[model samples]
Target: VASKSNLSLVGGNFTLQDATLSASSGQINLVSVASKGEIIPERGELGVQTPNISNFTKLGHIEMINSRAETTGSPSGGISIRGDQFWMDNSSIHADNLGDTDGKYIDIQTNESIQIQGKYFGVISNSFGKGDAGHIFINTPYLKIDQGTIDTSTKGEGNGGNIDIKATKIDVIEGGIIASDSYSTGNGGDINITATESLSVTDKRIFLTPEQADFTSTIGSASLDKGNGGRTTINTGQLIMDGAAISSNSHVSGDAGEILINADSIDMINGGTMTATVMSQSSGQGGSVTLNVKEKIYITGFRPGLSFTTTDVFENLQSAIVLITFGTGNAGNVNLLAKELVVDNNASIATATTGLGDAGNLTIEVDNLYVNNGGFISNSSGGIIGGKIFPGFGPAGTLKITANNEIVVSGQGAFSASGLLTNTLVSAPGGNIEIQTNKLTLADGGTISADSLGTGDAGTLDIKANTINLTDGGNITTSSAYAAGGNIAVTTSGLLFLRDGQITTSVGTGVGKGGDITIDNPIFIVMDGGKIKAQADAGHGGNINVKSNQFISSPDSLISASSKLGIDGQVRIDSPDMDMAGFLVILPGGFVEASMQNCNTRDGSSFKVSPRQRTVPFENKN
Candidate 1:
């Protein structure tokens, strides 16, 4: 059906299948009423149609399958649907502007629920000319989309329109998408989602086929050309993602947008990812990702047997939350705030740059944090460029973590240990790592390190905690290949314990000096067969300074600052309350003999107690 004017449809139960409805610069209204009500129509100043129902009652169901409703032109018309429940299968609602005028909006409101099911169908608002695209608004109690999409884009000089969704519960699964993009100079539209209860995005494919290798459930915005990507904001009670992706990315010279999420709890499992990235060959700056969760944030790596095959090669990717730049533009930052955070099973939270630009920082603040089984938190820079190694090519990003309660890192993964690290491989300066917590524990080969594998100085590592413990090969280290090693500083208020662990800084090659080690203001320090060394290959060794109230070490424990071909560094220990000789008391190895005389007259009438139960010869004499 084609109309040059307004189109209105009202019924108790409305269904449109395999049909098309077109309106040219006119309004289209579909209202389904379940109860008795009188509909009143009114016209606004611009001859816009508005329907006001007196004694408004309950709404009825509206279904559309393989159908389309669209308006295309300069200053295109709007589409509005009001019903109790709305279902669309293989259908689309589109508002397109082909002229120099701005397009109109698309509004959908349902009292019960809204479900969109299809493989590739969508509700789209687009701009193909110089005009801006239209906005989309959806309001419902529950919203579910299975493989369908709700999106906005701008291919012209004008900006894209925003999308706003408000629902109690939302589920987007099986390659479903909610996105906005800009393919030209215009900026992409923003997306805002607010769910009162929960929000989920998931995919079911465990083994990706060749055709579906790049496909997953997604919610994000992209800039493919000269336009900047759009921001994405999500607010919900609970957020869950499995084998899904949430990103704001750029492929060209446009900067990627930021992502913000607020939830009570968040879970990312089975290769789920949250990223802001600048792809290769792009000069656009990557965007940032911020997650503020009240309860906890849990992330697990890809499940076993989950792999993608390409050209006889199988690749497995871990679950991650990252900000990366592979272009000349700098990468963005990743910030997380939660009560508790757990990254396990090869999962990672990182910020990195593999291009000429610098990497961004990674910051986390939580009550408790656990990184186990090859989980990692890092910020790094430098990678292969033009088929050659670029060591420290750009400045690596820093990492800072603050935990109110405790921070624990333990276990190892396939190639790395669970740890916090900062690395650089180019000629630029490396990044630093700082952590502050009430208690810090590293065990089972866990590590905290800063390394420089190029001709650049290594970064520093600083830690402040109430108590520090390392056991079972847990280590804190800094190293450099051809530059000065990074320094390590640790301050603990309560105690420091190390068992079969190490704290070291070393330079492998060149005349670069080893880094220094400092431990200050600990009540007690104990090292049981632990090692603290700062060694250099060709340069001077680093100094070690330690100040504690009490210090104890095993015979096998080692603390050395040595250089093979250069001057050895100094090691100073200041402990005022440690005196092994003064605090120890020795006992004699002799027996005591006592002679006892008893009053016979008083003992005969009284009760006697025998302490040793021994018989005397005086009894035979009596």
Candidate 2:
């Protein structure tokens, strides 16, 4: 089982315990060398005598047990180990290529430490037929794997190989698996990890083996049918995960890969999961998850099994750290570039779609963005069951958040773009929630939503801030039922504050209509029980614009445009300075206007103000 062999063993210390080394069908080399000292000069000495090379404390330590090293068939050539220190507990290293060729390559170099522990340790390069599958290079300063398995697999049509690791320090505990798998049509492989200082994936407590009790620690890739899924790159300075999981998946029609992470600091606690998926009988598409952290990123949540005197508050929650995607094509993008981003307790960053494509796009570039307790950043799409004779649509995706300085959403945190309701069909719209911030804060029951129920339409909600704060029961919404209803734009340069917060656009019983609500501020304040709304039940109702220099409202605050069966909307206030003692309303054809005037006082004296108008008409129910 050898072809073109090269074996060298000149040692001072080299050990192989239960050995079985086969260089099957290839160019083989099994080498171990550490011995140098040949100098005898005393007869030609005269100002030239140099001979001293002796430093051996059992030089170049390497130990292998229950061993098996293999390269079996076709263009094969692999197996290399050069060491200062390397220990394999229950070893099995294979470079397998049986049918279509190409498979065999493994280079491991160690200067200080590398330890592979038990449970039948394996390092494999596999391919069933049609070529491809090989390459696994590791360079280490310190690397440890407790329950090991490093694999590259392919079932038939080839392709699947490439696992490069360079370490300063790396640890994979528990059931440890670093994998690349492609089952049928091939293609799936590529995992590069470079750790300059620290990288850890944990789980593994005291080995009480109940099948290792839910052992985690995994770095993966899998493509099942038409095959096409790879790419998982991590460049770390510090990355820590507790229950560990990093995945890339595609189940049927392929396409689902890409996960790039560059870290200076990243911490994912207990139920850690970072995934990119395209399943539900995939049609392709659904990948891309990028995280570039220069300073900090912490996604927390972890409760082993509820203790500390727990009385089962839903089993004491906390076990979340997820960046997810699910699909039928489309449902994959999540890019977070952070300086400081913290997502607490029920952590989540999601992109979802149930079937017909669309639903992916969540970008967060942070200087400082914190989402508290019930955290969530979502983009959703899925609904349409009965009804739709010829309606084909796919919309629901978009959430862009940029915080250059500060953005905080407290407690029941949520930022969503949703479309999932299908009674009379025509479903497909709901996406768009853009936020640009310098300072924006939403307290307590924080929520930002864009929703469309069926007949398509309901999206826009844009916020640009210099300073904007919504207190207590914070809420910002865009709603629709049989269509149209979505548009709420607020641009603030200095101050806009809403106390018991609420900003809405709504429509319910069919025929569409009910959207507009715009506020541009220099200084606008609504007190105690703040509210700004545009509502309609059967149709038309929208329009409430306020441009402020100074506009303050207090008695219980309220500015509304309402309709019960049809038309009624429009409430405009352009302020120079106004203190509305409380409510402003419009009921039928709408119209509640405010314009105050006369001011010239720096000694010329002319101060007068009085302007408030209203118009209303009922009965318009068609």
> Which candidate ranks first by TM-score, i.e. highest?
1
Q: List model 1 lDDT by residue over 119-233, tens digit each.
A: 7787888888888888888999999999899989899888888999999999999888898898999899999999999999987666545554535788999899999999999
lDDT of 2: 0.71
Clashing residue pairs, backbone N/CA/C < 3 A, model 2: none
Q: Considering only N, C-alpha and C atoms within 3 Å, which residue pairs clash in candidate 1? A: 391-425, 391-426, 391-427, 392-425, 392-426, 392-427, 392-428, 393-426
* lDDT (Cα, tens digit) per residue for candidate 2, span 1-622: 5563533333545778898777664433333335554322221121212222233323367787888777656644566666567788888778777667777677776668878887647778878778887777788889888888788877879888889989999998876778887888988789899999988987634333334344456787878778887888999899887756677777788886788999899888765667676666677776788999899988767535421110011222233322233445776788889889877766666665655777677888989888776766666565421122323245667888898998887774222211111111247777787899899888786667677767778788899988888888777878887788988899997888889988889988776789999998757555568899999888878889988878777788898988788888999989875445456664599655545455556666588887866857678899
- Model 1 misplacement above 4 A: 1-4, 41-50, 212-214, 303-314, 383-392, 577-579, 589-622
- Judging by lDDT against the true structure, name the best candidate: 1
Q: Candidate 1: minimum summed lDDT over ten consecutive residues — where?
A: 305-314
Candidate 2, residue 100: how far the Cα is off, in Å: 9.9
lDDT of 2 at 381: 62
